[model samples]
Target: MNPTKNSKRKTGRVFDPDATFLSNHPRLSIMILLFLYTVFLIVPSLLYTLFVTPIFYATHLYLLHIINFFSVAILWSIIVPLVLGLPNKREFIEYAKDIKIARIKPVLRSIGLGIITAFITLTCMLFANFLSSLLTGGQVQFVPQLLIHPGTTNIYTSLLLGIWEEVAFRGVMLVLILKIRSKRFSIISNGLLFGAFHSVNILSGFLGAILFGVEYNREHFIPVLFQIVYTAMLGTFLAYMFVKTKMLLPCIIAHYLIDALNTLVILNTEQLNWAYFCFMTFVGIGFLPMIINIPLVRSFSFWFPEPDDEIIPFFDTFLVRKQRLKQYKSDIRSA
Candidate 1:
């Protein structure tokens, strides 16, 4: 009996010498994946908030944002793929497909579809912000800090943020979860995790208050909580877009535009209270985008074929159910 064949039959998965040990253990791999991703993403900002910004003094905020951009880009774009043993072109392509970033056939059509989605989402976002401002009796004012700051930090940071986040959450996390669960489960799980990810801001605020004497109070908490909830819903939409488009670019572009616009303007109001927060969280971030983008994404389907939801790749083997493994071993023994 061939040992490798016997092993494959028992496990129901072809053995890959290069696959990481953790990849075979789904639960542990997931915990490690989230831990590492979160550490890399939040640590830089946290450190800056706690220590580096205070010491450096000038160019502090700019440096912090730049550091964040580089840290996120390097981790997701370069390090993760290399760690996954995707050195070969074909292997990398397969990895990309699994994550829904593959250059699907008819590349031009895909690019056009992505751009259209971005345009519609951005327009809707602006309208939502405007309506939110009007209803709250607030004025959307230019963010004076970003506007007065030197260089194009806002632009580049927004662009990189969009790329890094969509690639990390929608491209990678959502895809991995989808492999192991149903689409609804994967999408909702991703959204909740994404929402929880924003909770780090509370920590950052607390650190700032402790170290630099910045005020951290209930008012601050409210905004952070609102951000957590809003981003959660936004994450769900972004994941849906990835599913509908079968490409990651649309999500990235939409996220970038949203971030860039946010950096430009903020809702300013004399009546800054809980009522404002509640309205923004539920109506502005929640209901507004849903009303806007559903038709736009669907209308474009006729222009080109929607990519099938099926995502078969070697990673699927790593995520096999325990019952399947048991069945495979029992069949092999009987045979």
Candidate 2:
């Protein structure tokens, strides 16, 4: 044997030494798992709120509160971890140890990005509103119900929902998809899915979704803190962070801050001046930078290197090797 070839073989480590259990077609598995999980998590929660909670609570508000708590507990504690095979508490703690919180630059960059992204998001909304008005041939009337409802309670609720949604969609789903496809593919796919998920809103959901997709795709800065702050910008940033960092804590914190801020804004409309509204509108349009530059960025392609391909499938490979090793050991024992 050639000495160089022998040395190279000796230097190489075993792939997926832990023998983690993963699917061969990981992307398909993840999509299927997510769909099934959503059905299982949502149906029961909805039924409980509609049929069971209402019996006791009576009012829609009270019933909604009950459902919220129930969904949180079931989804966070039971469903997410068990069904999805998500990181356990112990594993999360270990992962946190590896994370260096001192890397605050990304977080700061994310704050900037958030502000710009928010501006762009607002701009899109205004643009959409204008388009909607032109199509209708009338001035768009602002419904007081839309404005007045969901006070402090709504803000807190939105924060919680934002965090959970980010963790599940971006953290779990996006990360899982990255295990099978390219990082770019994972980000865009997750972003589109995240955006589509928001279509239920009817008013700003589509625009919001597209913006969120963009945020997920751009992962140059620190994935953890930066992504979370970005999430604060439009509620979709944390989802983006989840995909980039594959961590939950920062995403939750960023989500909480953004929601809390929105809640404050929503609750204090009387205090807001025309300038504030104008500023928000301007910021919403900030996403245009990313939108226009995306093609150029893809063509340049420096942030993500090709060598990361093997590492991209880390989780999937671990699972397959683990299963194979177990089977091999069993066979040996039997022989």
- Highest-scoring model, lDDT: 1
Model 1 spans > 4 angstroms off: 1-19, 25-27, 46-55, 84-93, 104-136, 142-153, 304-335
lDDT of each: 0.65, 0.43
In terms of TM-score, the best-performing candidate is: 1
RMSD of each: 10.0, 13.0
lDDT per residue (tens digit) for residues 209-250 in model 2: 443343332222222223232233343344444434433445
Candidate 2 local Cα displacement, residue 148, angstroms: 6.1
* Worst 10 contiguous positions by lDDT, candidate 2: 94-103
Clashing pairs in 1: none
lDDT of 1 at 69: 81
